[model samples]
Target: MPLRSALAAVLVAIIWGLNFVVIDVGLEGMPPTLFLALRFAVVIVPAIFFVPRPKSRFRDVVLIGSFMSLGQFGLLYTALAIGMPAGLASLVLQAQVVLTVVFAALALRETPTRSQVIGVAIGALGLIVVGSGRGAETPALAFFVTIAAASSWAIGNVIARRIGRSGMTSTPLAGLSLTVWSALVVPLPMLALAFALHGSDAVGFALTHLTVPQLLSTGYTAWLASLVGYGIWNTLLARHPASAVVPFTMLVPPIGMTTAWLVLGEIPTIVELGGGVMLLLGVAITTGVLGSGRRRRLRS
Candidate 1:
């Protein structure tokens, strides 16, 4: 990848990493549902008018929207709400890479190479180390939720790959997602359950107790991170080879950790630092950044 692509990767990582801190801020007085509502609103309005739509069908729009917006964010935010730490949430989500490879092998018939298996094993080891460091009694529960979130994300990735070909991919993806959460998904049953389970106190507190900073944080998460951040990243994806570009995602967790430290004053644990390095190294190897066969094949 060019230095420009590397820098773009870093920019996306920084914006995303700060999102965990932003979510913490936004959740102060904002219900996750309402916050998500406001988020997509920003994308659909003034901005959507400016960006052109892709050539894909409404069904395709719904497909990617469900995976990318609904599935990915729903599980992720719920996991965070359920006591998953922000930086750790960022780190644990690395399970998506593993899920993606496995899904591709099964569904798309992509054969796994030796390099991928080695990368995944190292990545799994990093996940184990991170889990051990988490002070939770039921580390297994946290891990299960984290992995579920990753699997949902992987599903979204596959959908997005299809949508990205259309010129209007990002806008529709963002628009459809916000619409799903706000209009379809956030019906009375959802709120009724939220109220029943957490009580009006928790839900009520989130709404009335929100601040200006919190609102902006939520806006950033929905608009900038989802809309602009993913928009640019997907545009890059449309131009670059998947093997060349996708590897940059491993950099996101580290970026998120640094952002959490700087913004939230949460220093990374020693384990997080090591795990982050291992994860990135694993990604690098998986992407063929360390390829010897390429050189040999070139010579041949």
Candidate 2:
């Protein structure tokens, strides 16, 4: 990647890293479902009308929405509400990279190179180390929820790579509109599920509560974080390759931890920091960010 693109990737990284904190802020005054509804609603109104659609079907739009919008964010926020620590959740989200690699090979039938294979193995080990140290002295619902959310994120990443082939990088703002529509549409079935299984009180509680900060945060989450952030990311990767962009995402966890610590007064653990370093190293190796010119050419 060029210096400018690298810097752009880093900027995206900071926005994404701090995104967890923003979610915490947004959720403070709003319930998750209501917050998400408002968030998607903001993206879907005028922007959907103005934004051009990708070269895909309505189902593809739905799939993208499920994977990127609902699968990723929905599970993540739920994990936080359930029991996952903010800093740890930040670290756990990085697991999506490994999941993406696995999904790409399976879904797209694209085999990774030798370096990437090595990178994946080393990265998996690092993740295991980090996960082993999770502060769940006992099994907690939140820890499990966080893992489920991260798994969904991985699945979503595979779905995103599928979208990349559609020739619509600039349409992310449009995609957000499309994604929000899908989010609004698909969760209806789940609404029935939530009512039948979880009952009216849980469903009703998540729906009725509202506050200004939460509402503003929701708009910011969808419009700024999901729309603007993912928009730049899609554009960058469409111009480059996943290998070029994903490495910088490794920077997100460190920034996330830092933001959580400074802003939320959460303490950072040594294991978490180490895992973050290893995670970045794995990404660097996978993406050829630090290799020499000859080696970089060889990898390419």
Candidate 3:
């Protein structure tokens, strides 16, 4: 990848890492599902009018929206609301990195390089370490729910890659358009879920009484994270192999954990911190940054 592309990916990681803390803090005194509905609603209006629809099949757009935005964020917000720490939630979500590689290979026949395979194995080990350390402090239900969110995200990544690789999204705006258009799939179902969980009256109360912090959080998530971050990300997915792009997400946990600690006071346990280090190492190996130089020397 070019340095600019690499930096862009890292920028997305930082934005996303900060997003967890924002969600955790902002969701206070609010309903998770309802907040999600409002976030997507913000993503849709006005901007959707200017952005043309992605040329990919409508079903592809729907599938991407369903898995990536709806399923992933729906479950993730719920997990955080129930008990998952923002820092650990960020750490655990990196499971999508490994899952994305596996799903890409299975669904897209985008074979993983040997380093990718090894890196995935190491990354999986890191997940196991993190999982083992989730004691009474982290709710078991929340941990598993976040894993489900990761699975949804992985499926979405594959779908986005398929659309990108299909040569359908040829315009500079296709990725952003795909993001905006697909987000249309989120609100109604989330509103329904919110109503189911909290009753219509409660949902109405939360929406009407939104706090400034919550509104700020929604703007950050919708515009910066969903729009700008994913706009760059989907574009990158179109240009590079999924394996090459996805591993950069491993960089997210450090930023996520650090910000969560500083902002939310969610310090990780020793074991969880160790697991995060292992995850970074795995990402290094998976991205070929760790071993490529030695391989080049041997080749010479």
lDDT of each: 0.64, 0.67, 0.89
lDDT of candidate model 1 versus the reference: 0.64
Please give, for residues 165-227, the per-residue lDDT of candidate 1 as tens digits: 554334535433333332233234445655766687877776677789877886798676876
Clash number for every model? 5, 0, 0
Would you list the rank order by lDDT, best first? 3, 2, 1
Give the poorly placed runs of model 3, Cα more than 4 Å off. 296-300
Which residue pairs in model 3 clash with each other?
none
Ranking by TM-score: 3, 2, 1
Query: On residues 1-300, what C-alpha lDDT tens digit does candidate 3 reach at each position?
Result: 899999999999999989999999889999899999999999999789999988899999999999999999999999999999999999888888778878988998878899889988998898788888875779988999998999999999999999988884589887798889999999999999899989979988898898999999999999999999888888888888776798788778888888988988887888988887787677677767778768889999
Q: Give the C-alpha miss distance for residue 144 in model 2, angstroms.
A: 3.7
- Winner by TM-score between candidate 2 and candidate 1: 2
After superposing candidate 1 on the true structure, give the runs of residues whose Cα lies further than 4 Å from its correct spot: 1-6, 137-140, 164-209, 292-300
lDDT score, candidate 3: 0.89
- TM per candidate comes to 0.79, 0.82, 0.95
RMSD of 3: 1.6
Better of 1 and 2 by lDDT: 2
